[model samples]
Target: MTTVHERARPAAEVLEWGRATVDPAMREAVGALPDPVRHIAGYHFGWWDATGQPSEPTGKALRPTLTLLACQAVGGDVEAAVPAAVAVELVHDFSLLHDDVMDGDRTRRHRPTAWTVFGTGPAILTGDVLLTLAVELVAAAGPHARILTSAVLDLLGGQNADTSFEQRDDVTLSECVAMAVGKTGALLRVSCTLGALAGGATPDQVARLGLFGEHLGLAFQHVDDLLGIWGDPAATGKPVHSDLLNRKKSLPVVAALTSGTPAGDELASFYFAQPEFDPARAAALVEQAGGRDWSRERAAQLLRQALDTLNVAAPDTTATGELTALARMAVDRTH
Candidate 1:
């Protein structure tokens, strides 16, 4: 495992460069949308508030970081990969905008969600525009337009599976993993592949980077489940037990549900009960059923796979250490 250096300045600088690439392209693209849609997009990304005042505290821009790092790891000029990085971040934000609407989430980054403030219609339309712009950003670059569209379809399908899981207690762990691969993994996976292609990587390197992204995405989602249930509100920017309150049937919950333990049976009862919330007992039950521990171990394993794949593809690069360090930091993040 790469040491997570305590020095924050260097990582911040890399992330700032990543954001610079993403923000300008995003703004220019959103500017092409109708005024109402543009405002929704801006507000969602925390460029402004509902009333158009400037704001901070947007998302972490993780996808673009992965994009840019993959480019550099493959010995490509970071500047050449800027357009693809922007495209990756745009697609990610588009997904988030729609996800908030579909989940009826009222807040994000400690601020009101775009759908809540501007209404679902505008928020959804903004997502459509962002998706279109994502395509346009990568069009001139000429790598994976069809692949990007397919990823969107995968995202939609994954979201559908997630929503459908709410009504069915029969969800297997395999099914849950597959749904996650489609919903979250596909986007991250392709971001790496596209970045490598932009960097003039060969087909083999592209596949390796894509695999690394896939594993990283899985680890990320599993860690997200942990945060949803137990992360500090200040760090996570959401209320504790948010997943429990929502009964989200996330990866860990599904793992516990299918564990076939006595605790699993008890956990199922709580999930099916009306007025659904018993945070303390729910936490205990999941722990007793081994969901929490299982998820933690699985996340660690997936992260290892991501790093191993990265090492295989790009044995030496000026940016390899940064890529490894960032990948590890992503899984370790509280949020």
Candidate 2:
């Protein structure tokens, strides 16, 4: 394992190290699943193609990296945090599986989605299996099972709200933000919280790190919503103007709809008028209505808040620097 003091590795390198450290444990957990479910899970995880041949794995390993780093930041042994790391990663993947199915997404990580290849039922079942595995893995860790289950419940609530928003035009910015907190922030908060617990952190330290994760998670969603509008298809593995195409009332879109600017009115007209509206024009309207700028500014602000919380936790100096690097990389990415 790479020590934080060994050298100042880039955030990307830290992520790679985190992934490498957790992969064996992750694989072992997955290996315990029934064969059919395991096959779909492996396919979704980029471990193999539909035919079971080997394939290059994809994923930034962000959640698990946060878990390990949070442990190290609190002066806990990284190895002690491995199960927590794997557990969170499983939960993340489980969400992705369900998200793709619910969103009608055809691709992820530049490959066809598991639902598209293995059938929807199988994909959903695999997600359920993975989520079960997460709970089972964490059951031995004191307090971790309860923490993870609570986060899962919150995540489900957020997903429910997200789906419900699609049928209505009256979604408010606050409501949308609350939904993002559940949909994205819950798991991230738990990632840090569980890691801190595993590392034997003080209650105050755990709470502070959890706060940091909450801020970072919301910031991540803001950036993700931006990318959903303008990110390159090659990088995001989604269609151009994907959010607009789906008419998703994402943060920026909701901001624009509620902006009360003429551009906002026009965007609303375009958005709710018909199913065939132009996505590019809608993107332009969102920017004109200040949605893009607002989201960008909010993400930057939240990044600062997250860093402030991290500092208040009084973490190890080297781990603090690496965690800061990871947070910046997360907020500043193109995809």
Candidate 3:
């Protein structure tokens, strides 16, 4: 049994490689920006110190690792997938910046969020710049161009759906699944598709890989929901019960509320009433509703489904071993 810490070590190394590619590309892009725009973008990507000179810490770069691993799983050179990997990660970061603003989240990865440090206007522009960078990088990938554009469209659609669900009282599980597929799953699916595209995989092979990534992404979200409730603050780099405080409509909360337990009823009633976000009350609600356990079970099932699909997609056991390891690590992650 690989511990989450153990799994994260290698993923960290993978992230470093992706990070190496980003800074140089960012340098090229930043030079093209006007002075004030340049400063904001530089700070956002961690290329500048608070005083605004060169420094570093471009964040975890997890999505890029997924992109590279998908490429390798299809026997493509990881180097060939660098453009796509960078694009995906930049897109992910863009979402994170905007999400922080919308959620009123002041921090991320233990540092002030872009919007918190820069003003909301600058942070919004910074996110827009990153989105443009993603598009430009993806466009540079030539033959796989469509994958990038499609991912962008899907990402926007997902974000819209996620916001729409927040106000509605009657969101179903299936609807949530669709939203997840678009929001979280879309880029993940594209990572695999980009890999196949880079590797010159057959059309059928590309389709299967997309399906594999989609399932893995669904499982990833399930696990994330679990951690948001139960994960330790030290390990996760956020306050415990951050999602509860945010009133995020994640998988576990949805499942528990709909499951018909006494705890569930209490939760649903509390949620409908829109009680103030008290950390103690939120934690109690999660415990009472068995949200954590329900979410863990769902994550396990989705992981199994993902593995089953991978078996069909890449029959060569040796070829897919790394990717299989990554899939297991994703669902089993604590943070």
Residue pairs with clashing backbones, model 2: none
Q: For each candidate in turn, give its C-alpha RMSD to the true structure in angstroms.
A: 2.7, 2.2, 3.8
How do the predictions measure up, each by TM-score? 0.93, 0.95, 0.86
lDDT of 1: 0.84
| Residue ranges of candidate 1 with Cα displaced over 4 Å | 1-10
Output the better candidate (1/2) by lDDT. 2
Alpha carbon lDDT at 93, candidate 1:
85
Q: Give the per-residue lDDT digits (tens) of candidate 1, residues 54-145.
A: 98848778788778888988889888787888888889888889888887888877888888888888889889888888888888778568
Native-to-model Cα distance after best TM-score fit, residue 70 in candidate 3, in Å: 2.1
Better of 1 and 3 by lDDT: 1
The sequence of per-residue lDDT tens digits that candidate 2 reaches over residues 24-121 is 99998898788889989888888999999999988999999999989988889999999999999999999999999987888788889999998999
Can you give the lDDT of residue 84 in candidate 1? 83
Alpha-carbon RMSD, candidate 3 = 3.8
Answer with 1 or 3, whichever has the higher TM-score: 1
Task: Return the clash pairs for model 3, or none.
Answer: none
Span of ten consecutive residues with least summed lDDT in model 2: 1-10
lDDT of each: 0.84, 0.91, 0.74
